[model samples]
Target chain A: MSDLADLYRDVVLDHARTPHGFGLRDGAAAESHQLNPTCGDEVTVRLHLGPEGAIEGISWEGHGCAISQSSASILADLAPGDSPEQLRSRIAGFRAMMRSRGEVEGDEALLGDAVVFQSASRYVARVKCAMLAWVAVEDALLKLG
Target chain B: MSSIAPTIAAATALEESEVYRLREDFPILREQMGGHPLVYLDSAATAQRPVQVLDAEREFLTHLNAAVHRGAHTLAAEATEVFEQARETVAGFIGARPDEVVWTSNATEALNLVAYALSNASAGRGGPEADRFRLGPGDEIVATEMEHHANLIPWQELAARTGATLRIIHLDDEGALRLGEAAEVIGERTRLVAFAHVSNVLGTVNPVEHLVSLAHAAGALVVLDACQSAPHRPLEVKALGVDFAAFSGHKMLGPNGIGVLYGRAELLNALPPFLTGGSMITTVTLERAEFLPAPQRFEAGTQKVSQAIALAEAVRYLQRVGLERIEARESQLAVRLHSGVASLPGIRVLGPGLGVERAGLVSVVVDGVHAHDVGQYLDDAGIAVRVGHHCAQPLHRRYGVTATTRASTYLYTTEAEVDAFLERLAGVRGFFGAAS
Candidate 1:
């Protein structure tokens, strides 16, 4: 049960139960739908940017595991008020952590509750689940430019 | 009365103890996964191979390894004999002639072979005889909504390539095909009707005889995807009256990289080869060349000789156990699984309800839980199941679900394993806080 507990931490469950910005926004300038074909999990991420290309708001709609849904919630909470440059670095850090094969210690200050997915890196099949929302946000941000 | 009834009764009686004995042959069943004894309920994805299948392949590679049908040397001749003999065993297992069985990479390629060949025919590759397969804008290709992507996509592509319309027979609420509409959909203009013998997702045992009759009535060829059925039931391609059928070896306890495509000899000979070059040619000049007759013409390049040998061993293993007995045992397992889960609150079982005859599998959706979470919970309990659309998205869409968690059984599956799976599934809603 330790492995399952490590993967489904309290913070992850909390975020999944009450995901931030779960509804779609009107006049969203950038959006992308990301699908994990293997599991059929899909997420459509929408981003509203401020004047300086800083993320003014973030929201998503999807049906997936707690990991993916919670990851999306955490992204919505963290992406707003960050400039595109800051968001890029944060995304890069998260991607690096996911690809670390459980070797790299996830940086909580940077990734926030999304750092709870560190244990998922050990399970090759689930890394994609943790990364689905992140990848969608990355795609949406790319569309912003 | 038919002799089939007595044989099934005897096999069912024997399988009461035979299934327990059969587990000893599969070594992996003894191992631990996720700190508990592994409960493999994902045989629909791919079956665990027995030591006999392993030994057969190893024996061939060690002693009889050589390029088949090529050389005058002793090893080459021996390999060729073994390869062709494996083909005979496979063909016999499905009640077809050895020449009617063409080997391919897997069932996916086997299906693509038929679709692509029909496309070739439409393009004037197989001449007049092949024109029976050709379709135009006014013509139609009939498929059911319950098809796996392997069975569905190829026909869709064929219809796209030709000007034929791709029509579907939709599923009812219980996931059964609305087969009453078959007469109307499979009209004279229908060139082909392809569907799964048993659905990978729903475990629905389709009315193959009825569907084949309808196709025949319209003078349309039938292509059966037996990936789910061939492993669990006794199949006779001739008796089923299908013009062509495709099934994979791995799902039937054989090695991967080997599959069989069964077709009527005349249709196969008329349909141009899907893959070309090497081994399949009868004569070769740079200017023009002639091809060999099927199943040789369909089998291009060096074949999966050892895998075919191992697959033959797998077929022999199933025969020794008796497919009827295996089917009987699995039906009981399916009943236990369905009834056990059906009693739980807020659990929606896909396909047929508890009492209907289905293949040895069940897929379900929890009221408030995602299938991935349910799958994770099961995995934690040492249960392995497939969680997704099960490669039948259109069927899942029809059921208004994005995904489902499925537990499928095999010849070696035990009552205890079914109980364990049900017990784990019973707790999924609670663990995810979806329970009332």
Candidate 2:
């Protein structure tokens, strides 16, 4: 029960109930449709880039498990106003943490509330669910540069 | 690793007491997961292979390892004898002649062989008799909305290539195909009717006899995806009256990389070959070649030699246990599983409702919890089940849910395991705090 609680923290449940930037946005610079074929979880991410090569805004919409949906909601909060390079570093850090298999602690200062997903790394099958939204963010970010 | 665990006693000595004994034959079932006895409820995905199958493959490889057919050595002759004997055994199991069975990589390839052959016939590839298999713009290929992607996609591609129309028989709220609309869906222009004998997700045993009759009356051929049925009960292709049927070896306590395609003798000889290569050919030239007949024509490259031998051993194992008894045990387990799960709060069993008989499986969708969460919850408690669209996206769409958690039974599955599955499942909604 403690492990389940750690994986499904209150913050994740709250984000799942009311997500940020969940609808489509017009005039976005790039868009991507990502699907986790195993569970039929899908997400469409749209990003708006400013003239300085910075992320001006981001939006998304999808349906899946709380892990995937909450991850997308968290990404909506974390991905905006950051340069593509910054987003790449965060994605790389998140990937490393997930691959650690509970060996490495998630850096709270860098990942913020997203660090709550560290417990999800123990489940090999659910790791993809946590990464689905970040993958879309990566693709959308690449289109900006 | 330091201590050996004591063996648990067999659960019951009922009419199907052999099922309890059968559990000891599968070594993996004895292992523990997460400090609890492993409860395997996902046999529909792929069943665990018994020791007889494993030993059969090993023994063959250790003593007689040679390519079958077209060899002069003694080992080759011995291997060929064993291979041909396996074909004969498989034929007897399905009530077909050895000449009527064609071996392939898996059920997916078996189905694609038939679809591609029809496509070839449409392109004027086969000889005169193949005209019975060709199709064009006005022709329609009818399948049900509940077909697995393997059965549905090939026909879709065939239609795309041959300018044919693809129609489907829709499912009702219970996930059963609406056979009431069979006549309207399958008209004179319908060239082929393809469907599953038993749905992998819904567990609904389709009315194959009735559907075959309708297709025959319309002058259309019938193809049955027996992937889910062949392993669960006694099957005779002649009695079913279908032109073709397909099943995978891995789903029936056999090794992987082997499958069987059963076609009526005359129909097989008439259809064009889907693959062409060494063993399937009679005489070869730079220009054109003469092809072998029926089963040989479809088997292109080197076959899964040891896997086929292991599959034959699996057939023998099933025979020894008696499929009728196996079927009865599974039916009782499925009824208990369905009723127990359905009785839980906020649980919706997909497919058939209460008092309705289905195959030995049950799929469920919780009210507010996703299937993935339910699966993880179950997995954490030492129970393994299948959670996904289960390769039937269109069928999932029809049911208005993207995914489901399915628990399936087999000959080795026990009543206590079903109870554990239900007990673990009963707490999922409460675990997720889903309103009941």
Best by TM-score: 1
Candidate 1 lDDT score relative to the true structure: 0.89
What lDDT tens digits, residue by residue, belong to model 1 across residues B228-301? Answer: 99998888889899999999999999999999999999899999889999999999998976889999999899
**What's the TM-score, to 2 decimals, of chain B in model 1?**
0.97
Residues B10-49 of candidate 2: C-alpha lDDT, one tens digit per residue: 2221244666678889999987987878899999999998
Off by over 4 Å in 2: A25-27, A48-57, B1-16
- Please tell me how candidate 1 rates in CAPRI terms: medium
Clashing residue pair totals per candidate (backbone < 3 A): 0, 0
Alpha-carbon TM-score of each model against the true structure: 0.97, 0.95
lDDT of each: 0.89, 0.87
Chain B TM-score (each prediction, in order): 0.97, 0.96
Kindly report the fnat of each predicted structure, to 2 decimals.
0.64, 0.71
Q: What's the TM-score of chain A alone for every prediction?
A: 0.95, 0.94
User: Model 1 residue A101 lDDT?
Assistant: 83
In model 1, where do residues sit more than 4 Å from their true spots?
Answer: B1-6, B9-16
